[model samples]
Target: MENTMTKSILKNKCLIIDGTRAFMMVWLGQMISFIGSGLTSFALGVWVFQKTGDITQYALISMFFILPGVLLGPLAGTLVDRWDRRTTMFISDLGTGLSTLSIAVVYLLGGLQVWYIYVAVFLSGAFGSLRMPSMQAAMTMMIPKKSLGRTSGLMEIVQIGQFLIAPIVAGGLMESIGLAGIVMIDFSTFLIAISILLFIHIPRATVTAEGCAGQGTVLQEAVYGWKYIKARPGLAALMVLFAFTNFTTEMTVVLFTPLILSFASTAKLGLAMSLCSSGFLVGGLLMSIWGGPKRRVPLMMILMILLGVFSTMIGLRASVGLIVVSGFLATLTVPIISSSNQVIWQKKVAVDVQGRVFAIRRTITLATPLVTYAIAGPLSDLVFEPLMTVNGALAGSFGQVLGMGPGRGIGLLFVCMGLLTTLVTAIGCLSPRLRKVEEELPDAVITQSAQVKIEKKLPSLLPARSPRNKIVYAKCHDLKPPLPELLSRD
Candidate 1:
């Protein structure tokens, strides 16, 4: 009995040691790069708000992140599936570096306009649209399922670490080197990421048995993602649900910044943003240690409830401390949501096809942020601002608390938005489908588990199979294709 216990402890330690290398290979470079990127992003956001002092201009920064992703997702997803994933990631890092260098040059040249910054941000989004999905897809291929929860939790910690530090760093850096220094930091980190990535080799992915997923025309491959998602009821539902959540969150944010700014200043904006990062940091830390509940859906629902409460709190009254605390609470649930979502994909999707499937998945998931960017500016600037004022529609009652003038009116609208988000969650939870996601969307078991679940049942498949089995075989990561498809494939 003692020997058995000792062996178990040693095995657990070995797993940790193995994971430490994986974390360095996968997570460390990303975390360092993200911190630098966060610094640049925060610096840009504050600079815009400080210079224009307009909420619309502030929201445009988000557009820079969203528009390109939505517009280019289809093609990007196809190409990502078609290319070598590690190379794709390296290229993405390099692309961002190039963009950063250009922005730095523009700053030095003193030709840095709102339009230039906007364009750079858009380009970064475009490149990022390619990079993020590839990285996500790679994780499933490389990491073991049992450890996925921990790995994703650690990655979130890294992300939150960046956010927690960025605002504080950006704020101080602004006083010292301005935008150029932030851009410079971003540029350097990308190089560091590229250097690390150069050493890791990811085997090229290709479909087998049924047909080559990569040999098709762009449109053919792109449509396949649509077909793939439609075939899986659970995956489609996750995408659509996340799209709504993303849209609402984006819209609320458009309203959120202005609401806070009215009650405070740009520096206060930095402080609030940093504090918001604290919620994510703390949440991530807890997740890395405790992990999540075995059932993911319930945990996600509870997190959504907290998000609604916090959103409403920020809008109801604009105390700086209250706003910062509320923002912190709003992000606190992120690690749970994100890590679980990653586990879902890693388990359900095949590593080979994950590149395309996840790409399309990410593309659609990104739509809300784009929609928010598109509409938030107009709605807050024009409609809500007008309706909630002293002499406007709700002036008699709401105007007393929200006030007659500019910022508070917008704040009131944001409060209403928070309620709407909460209502949506209530409705979503009541859905039989989302509630039963586990039963319906069972994890997409890998064809051959490298360990205990290794396939003892390697069923034989002829070159041309029964059509349905043929397609299934083609999609399997375990099925190595006939030579020509594997060799002439890329």
Candidate 2:
């Protein structure tokens, strides 16, 4: 009786929802999960930092969180393409939720170690790899092309909860219900996200010439994402630009907490983080409504330059106010830039091939961050921290302006990295291929119909010249009804 009523309710709800409304259902669930996860993340970071007080060890948590996902991206993407996207997401959420539960169990048993958290984070990341590509590929089917920008913007609101609200709440909760309680909340959010998946419908991607060409053994299909991008110079160049920018971004992210903690209390750290990150919320809201400019490439470049400027400001002084204002402005640009970039990929890549292509893109861009996370700790601790000390070598020279203190070395490093980011963006703007990508690349045809209709007509529509190489005309254009039906007499 319960099962039947649940199904009835789902069917009744789904009946009124169009593609956009369906996406909203999914988005709301993800937003809740983000907030829940954010609370745990904030608590964990504080716990680890207070327990160890070593920057290198603190940095390892992030590395472990990211490395497994980056390494598994290609394989995960292939599976996402082969599986029902909703099912794939369901499994991903379950796996991550279990990982969270394991940490809680360990803590309850009084056997929880930092290393245990690392292992759990690694497992969570492996599961998360599937969730990322699955969500991206599913979006194309659930949203109209015109609304893609707004959808991306709306998605950034999840980050607002994760980055802004989570830190503040987590800080207060840490003194009350504690980390185990926080982890339990995260697990509950995952269940809620999984439940939402059962009530929504995502249309399967219709196979096209591009998708057919990509078909083969598992290895062949995984490699296909790379081949598709290489054939498109514009996308390749854009990937390179993102690779460098993401590197700087990660370096800043890894260092931001430690930098603040070096000179202030954990309470202050949480406040600065939450307040500065409000920029993401402001930016997300703006993008949700504005949907960005038509000429997205130029807008992305301009935002990148501004991001570099704000990043530099983050380390200018150890003052909380400076970091808060600068950090706010910096984060404000993130959603707009990310939304613009995502819209470009959605428009350029065929729907069926997006899983593989987006995975490959994420793998390449994310690989750079592994280097940043690995070196961010040792470099800051061994090199930058030493050089910025009051009586150190740099105190007589470079330290004169930036000041010589505990976190000053990181501040100087932030200045240099931010300047480099600006320089890199400026150089990237000179690449003609990247600047003219919109003009050179054709917007892919995305049909918003049930998969059965297109798949049923696919066999008769194939071209003969090269079965996989030639474009299927009917798939690219609207399919007309059969002539027999039009000519029949009653």
lDDT of each: 0.69, 0.82
Runs with alpha carbons beyond 4 Å of true place in candidate 1: 1-20, 44-61, 109-115, 201-215, 399-406, 445-490
Tens-digit per-residue lDDT, 397-428, candidate 1: 88777567677667776677667777787878
**C-alpha TM-score for every candidate:** 0.81, 0.87
Assess candidate 2 and give its TM-score to the true structure: 0.87
Residue 290, model 1, lDDT: 73
For candidate 2, the clash count comes to 0
Question: Model 1, residue 316: what's the lDDT?
Answer: 69
Supply the TM-score for candidate 1: 0.81
Please identify model 2 stretches exceeding 4 Å from their true place: 1-18, 47-55, 262-265, 389-397, 449-490
